[model samples]
Target: MTQIAINRPCPPRRRFGLSLLWDALSLHRQRRTLARLDTRALEDIGITREQAEAEAARPLWDAPEFWQK
Candidate 1:
């Protein structure tokens, strides 16, 4: 045959990398939302505006400690 298509599962390394990227993006979006929360909302969440700003300012690649393991 001149050519034939083959199906294969994603490689482990590539899957891990893609998963990491997705997690980082999700964190970025969540942090943005956190940063926009009003005073009441921040109070409801038990975090101050300063704390939210600090979290929002973090780099995307800086995943939470729990996520590292």
Candidate 2:
């Protein structure tokens, strides 16, 4: 009996562009939810309606730096 070794091809790595798209979509959804929150709900989270509005007004791809990680 003889032992044999086989080499397999590695799968392709995911492109960074896909992650960016996903992040943008997530940001859009979060902003929409934030915009829909009532003043009372916003207050509970210590955020003013104007602040929420400002955040929601940002572009989908304008996510915070931390999100890139």
In terms of TM-score, the best-performing candidate is 1
Q: Quote the lDDT for 13 in model 2.
A: 64
Q: Which structure among the candidates has the greatest lDDT?
A: 1
The per-prediction CA RMSD against the true structure, in angstroms, equals 7.4, 6.5
Model 2 over residues 1-69: C-alpha lDDT tens digits?
A: 999777987776654787768878888999999999998999999999999999999987678987645
Residue pairs whose backbone atoms clash in candidate 1: none
Q: Which stretches of candidate 2 lie over 4 Å from their true place?
A: 1-15
Per-residue accuracy of model 1 over 1-69 as CA lDDT, tens digit each: 598667987554443777777888899999999999999999998999999999999988788897865
> Candidates' lDDT values, in order?
0.87, 0.86
